[model samples]
Target: MPHCLYLKHLDIVPGDRANPCKGLMKPITIVYSSKKGYPLVHPCTKCGHLSRNKVAMDCTQED
Candidate 1:
């Protein structure tokens, strides 16, 4: 089954734009399926932006 997830923390404070003082925050999309071998990837859903760095955009593990 293909599961679709919508990111909670996207675009710095849940908006399309970002704050200059806070910096730009982006959305991260993760896919986990045995058929695809849990391909860990991040693609901005808020604005269709792509980033090569996964760790930088990880908001779930943040303190």
Candidate 2:
């Protein structure tokens, strides 16, 4: 499963062209999952755009 926490700038594509600040997925520490086990609400901290797709896992964690 993709973790919709923090992602790199090169990993994801821009969701909206109207957003002036284009960057990585800056998770706002908020996460919401749907009943079907899918991420429904994942907002970006840079542009505040809500991403409702599969996201990559956080890179800051050590496996």
Candidate 3:
């Protein structure tokens, strides 16, 4: 079974907490790869933001 990562409550308010609105709204989830058997390669806060996993320079050069 593939594990799923849940992301929620990602709202940033420029001002005070009172009357704050949800900004940049998004519900994010990550799934593990079946063949590679690797976890999501990135830094994700409990808030649900997924970091961009850039291909390594050396690996790309091989192709």
Candidate 4:
């Protein structure tokens, strides 16, 4: 998933791309939660915006 579609940026906020920081988000780590299951933590390569998204059912830890 694209971070611009999910991450909360500076003033632009989440689920929006109105901001000028069109940075590519890279997955940094994965965390397991009892409620949310496994979510991957991603941070923008340009502006450093961070976001966590639930991994797809078919996705593996190596991804």
Of the two candidates 3 and 4, the one with more favorable TM-score, higher being better, is: 4
List per-prediction Cα lDDT, in the order shown.
0.41, 0.51, 0.34, 0.68
Judged by whole-model lDDT over C-alpha atoms, candidate 3 comes out at 0.34
| Minimal lDDT window, size 10, model 3 | 54-63
Write model 1 residue lDDT over 1-63, tens digit each, in one string. 443342332354435656333323243445556555444454554444443333333334422
Tens-digit lDDT string for candidate 2 (1-63): 443455543324554454445566654433456643445354565666666655445454442
The per-residue C-alpha lDDT of model 3 at residue 52 equals: 28
What residue pairs clash in candidate 4, if any at all? none
Worst 10 residues of 2 by lDDT: 3-12
Residue-pair clashes per candidate = 0, 0, 0, 0
C-alpha positional error of residue 29 in candidate 4 after TM-score superposition, expressed in Å: 0.7
C-alpha TM-score for every candidate: 0.25, 0.34, 0.19, 0.60
Show model 1 residue runs off by greater than 4 Å: 1-40, 54-62
Model 2 scores a C-alpha lDDT of 0.51
Per-residue CA lDDT of model 3 for 1-63, tens digit only, reads 442232222334423444232233232433456554433343344333443232223232221
Model 3 clash pairs? none
How much does candidate 2 score in TM-score? Answer: 0.34
lDDT of 4 by residue, 11-63 (tens): 46655667787767677788999999989898888888778877667543421
